[model samples]
Target: MTTRSRTAGPILLAATILVGLMAGTFFIFACAVMPALSRSEDRVFVQVMRDINDVIQNPLFLLAFMGALLLSAAAAWQSRAEPHRWWTWSGCAAYALVFLVTVVVNVPLNDQLASATGSATAARADFEDAWVAWNAVRAGLSVAGLGLLAAALTVRGRR
Candidate 1:
């Protein structure tokens, strides 16, 4: 194999792993975290979510969240000349969808939820259900992106 192809294989693999990591994180939030949060009293839930939002902004999570975008972009670029380019390209698009939704929908909601004052119940009413709904979309998009990246890896292997 040529040097470029050899390099593309590993880059794409790393991108797939990062995308999977993001997908798993969102899936857990949907399936486990949100359900538990839903059971909490409104004040406790709001406080817990605020704390979580603060903690989740740490460097490691940032790496995975942002790395998925950067790495997928790299993978798409590297695989551009390959026969299986569509898979990587589509993976990139899916990741973009995830990012855009998070930035446009989720982050603003989180910000609003975090800084909310007066009535926790009112905040919960305004934020929690809608946030959960947006998160489900993120979960699905990230998973789809991961699956496409996995498909790209498989196609690369076959080449």
Candidate 2:
């Protein structure tokens, strides 16, 4: 393989793994932890969700997002002159779509929830509705990203 292809392949793989981890975290956070917290009458769940939101808004998440974006972009650029070009482009497209949905739908909902009153009972209905809607979209996008990642891997292996 050419030097450029060698470097780009590992970077693309790392990006795929990063995206998968982020997407997996979303599933675990929204589906398992949040649901458990919401069911409890204790305020612990509210606090947990708030903490989670804060963490999600932290610079680390943004940095990871940016890294994923860059890696995908790099992969696309290299793929233009390499084999398995479609896999790289498709993976980038899927990751971009996931990021777009997160920025557009999920982030706003999270911001609203963060500013909301902390009373679990009062906020339960609204939180649940928003969480369900946002998570549904997130889960769908994550699955698509996973599929694209798998395709990319297959293509890379064949090269």
Candidate 3:
């Protein structure tokens, strides 16, 4: 392999893994956490979700969250000369959408949910459905990105 392709291989691998981690996180929330929360009492749902949002800001999550974007971008750039570069480029594009949705839609909704007052039921009503819907969307997008990255890694050197 060429020097750039060799370099791209490891960076792309790390990017794929981080993206997969994030994809699994969103998928778990969509398929399990939100579904379980949907059946809970409003107080329980609101409190648990608030706690989750608070706790999810720690280092490890941030690493995966930010690393997925940064590394995927790096991987795409590094692989730009490879014949199979389109997969990495497309994967980065997909993750870019995931990042955009998280920032634009999900984070703002989380902020809105955080500031909600008066009743737990009201907070849950405002937060749960929208959060669940967007989580599902991000999950699908992240998974697709992961698939594209993995394809880039495994199908290297091909046209």
Q: State how far residue 71 of model 1 sits from its true place (Å).
A: 0.5
Per-residue accuracy of model 2 over 95-156 as CA lDDT, tens digit each: 78778877887777677767877566666556667776777677667667766766776787
Give stretches of model 2 more than 4 Å off: 1-3, 42-44
- lDDT per residue for candidate 3 within 1-159, as digits (tens), equals 677756777888999999999999999999998998888899998888988999999999999999999999999999777765899999999999999999999999888878898799888888888889999999999999999999998878454
lDDT ranking from best to worst? 1, 3, 2
Worst 10 residues of 3 by lDDT: 1-10
Candidate 1 displacement at residue 69 in angstroms = 0.5
Per-residue accuracy of model 1 over 1-159 as CA lDDT, tens digit each = 788767887888888999999999999999999999999999999999999999999999999999999989999998888877999999999998999999999999999998888799999999998899999999999999999999998888886
Screening candidate 3 with a backbone cut-off below 3 angstroms (N, C-alpha, C), the clashing residue pairs are none
Better of 2 and 3 by TM-score: 3
Model with the higher lDDT, candidate 1 or 3: 1
All-Cα superposition RMSD per candidate: 1.1, 2.6, 1.6
Q: How many backbone clashes does candidate 3 have?
A: 0
Query: lDDT of each prediction vs. the true structure?
Result: 0.92, 0.72, 0.91
TM-score ranking from best candidate downward: 1, 3, 2
Clashing residue pairs in candidate 2 (N, C-alpha, C atoms within 3 angstroms): none
Q: Deviation in angstroms for 132 in model 2?
A: 2.6
